[model samples]
Target chain A: MSLDPSFVGRTYPPTAPYQVGREKIREFATAIGATDPAYHDPEAARALGHPDVIAPPTFPVVVTMAASRQIIEDPALGVDYSRVVHGDQRFAYTRPVAAGDELVCVNTIEEVTTRGGHGFLTTRTDVSTAAGEQVVAVWSKIVVRGEA
Target chain B: MELPTQTFRVTRADLVRYAGASGDFNPIHWSDRTATKVGLPGVIAHGMFTMALVGRAVTAWAGAPDAVVDFGVRFTRPVVVPDTDEGTEIEVSAVVKEVTEDGLTRLDVTATCLGEKVLSQARATVRMAR
Candidate 1:
């Protein structure tokens, strides 16, 4: 099934604030084998001018994945999640995320198209501090394989 | 200038840990049955996991953990894991594409597994060391 082209430019409501945790950042860094002291020790992070342990560059995906449910699960959109495959990902940061920061995500549908019987959906997530300070912009593209 | 190449091993255990940490419990990353049922060759590494590894390489080249300003990649192929302790390896190398007047360095990165490119159009921009 093809994604509705009209859904392009649709924006979802801001998600509930997610508090970035030091231990979570440590865990993610460990999982990725990022042994930088700034990822594990607050003192090291402080020396680097961060308020707390900073997350890896790709760590925002953890928060955005959950927030994106609003768009992926939209009944009107009629997406078949089982047939989806990731296509592209991009992140532009205003600042690296740090522990104790309260973050929120606003998801917007940037593009929707169909080519070669596959549906291409692109979403842009604006991650920001609860205080409305912009943090990063995350973009993801997923391809819905055609049921041949 | 070309940066030193870095290689990281990817095992099924690593995939399990990444799935838990990243809150992406997609069975295709861990369960072969689910993966095969989904038309995949076998269990596969999450694209985000590969991206994270590339991010590590980029930050290492920039000489800072939080140096990344922009990063992006296209998932051209899956990094298939064959359920072995030996697992697989991803080799990451990059070339300095540009150094901006504002002290940012742009890199064109490449990530490959088993001599096959897994990511395309991979790139990162980082704060150059002062």
Candidate 2:
């Protein structure tokens, strides 16, 4: 199914705040074999100038994944979820996400196009604190394969 | 300059743990039935998992935690993990692409499974240690 190019530049409302937790950060770090003390120990993180344990760079995916559902599940978008695959992912940060930060995401449809038999959608999610302090920007590109 | 190479073992249990931690219960990462039904060659590792491991390599090379300012990757291929005790392994290596005047170091990274590139256009920029 082809995506509507018109949807490009559309912005969605801010998602509910996702509170970053120390244990969640630890779990994510452990899963990837990242034993950095800043990801697990608060004192260690504080020594590095963080308020608390810091999350791994990719940890924002936990929030943006749910936030993106607004776009992917839009009936008008006509995305066939079964045929979808992650094509690209990117993250740029203003500061590391620390445990106890209430992070919110505002998602935007950066681009929508079709090539051959597939649909490509690019989304940019701006993550910020509830107080509106920007923390990071995450970009995701997904490919919707044509029916076989 | 080339960074030291690192290898990580990915077992079926690791995938399950990652899925739970990352909240990606797509089933394709754990269920062979769901994976094969979806045209996959048995259960596969999550592309994000592979990226996270690469992130570890990048931070290690930078010699600082929380130093990454930019990171990106293209998922070019899947890492198929067989149902065995020793599932599979991914090897991550990188080269310093540039060091900016503003104290940032950029790295071009490569992650491979079974000698086939699984991630392409992989790169990261990190704050140089003070």
Candidate 3:
């Protein structure tokens, strides 16, 4: 089934605040083999001007992915999760996400289209501090393959 | 104009760890049965994981952990990992695309696995470390 273009510009409510933890950042950094000291040591991070341990550039995906469920699970959208393949991802950061920060995501459907009998869904997630400070804007595009 | 190249090894264990860390416990990344059932050759690394590895390379090049200001990539091919101890390898390399007057350095990044490009239109902009 093709994606409904009408879903474009649809915005979801902000997710509950997620407290960033130092252990989570360290785990993610280790999983990706990022050996940077700032990713694990708070002092190293502070030396680089961050308040605490800093997450990698793509770390926001760990949060935005769950936030995006609000859109993909919408019955009106008709997305087949089994057939979804990530197409593109991008991030623009106002600052690094530091451990101990409380973050919330506001999701928006930026585009929807059909090509080659497949559906493409694009979403933009605005991540901000619980206090309303913007941290990053993340964009993701997924292609839902048509059944053979 | 050219930055140093960095290589990362991907293993089944690494995928498992990443899945746990990232909360992306997709069976295709761990279960060979599920992967074959889904038409994938075998277990495949998450595209986000691959992107994160490249992000590491970007920050290393910029010489600071919080240097990245913008980053993007298109997943062109899957980085298929075998069920072996050695798994596979991905090589990440970049060249300076441009340096803005505002202290941002743009890089044209490339990531390849098994000699095939895995990410396209890969680019990053980083704030130079003072």
Query: Which is better, 2 or 3, measured by lDDT?
Result: 3
Task: Give the winner by lDDT.
Answer: 1
Given candidate 3, what's the lDDT at residue A110?
Answer: 95
Error of 2 at B87 (Å): 0.8
For each of the candidates, the C-alpha root-mean-square deviation to the true structure, in angstroms, is: 0.7, 0.8, 0.8
Cα lDDT of model 1 by residue, B70-128, tens digit: 99999999999999999999999999999999889999999999999999999999997
The residue-level lDDT of candidate 3 at A63 comes to 93
Q: Rank the candidates by DockQ, best first.
A: 1, 3, 2
What i-RMS does every model get? 0.3, 0.6, 0.5
Q: Residue A103's C-alpha lDDT in candidate 2? A: 94
Q: Which ten residues in a row have the lowest lDDT in candidate 2 chain B?
A: B56-65
Candidate 2, residue B94: Cα displacement in angstroms equals 0.7
Q: How close to the true structure is residue A127 of candidate 1, measured as C-alpha lDDT?
A: 100
lDDT of 3 by residue, A17-99 (tens): 98999999999999998989999999999987889999999999999999999998999899999999999999999999999
Scoring only the A-chain of each prediction against the true A-chain gives TM-scores of: 0.98, 0.98, 0.98
Off by over 4 Å in 3: none
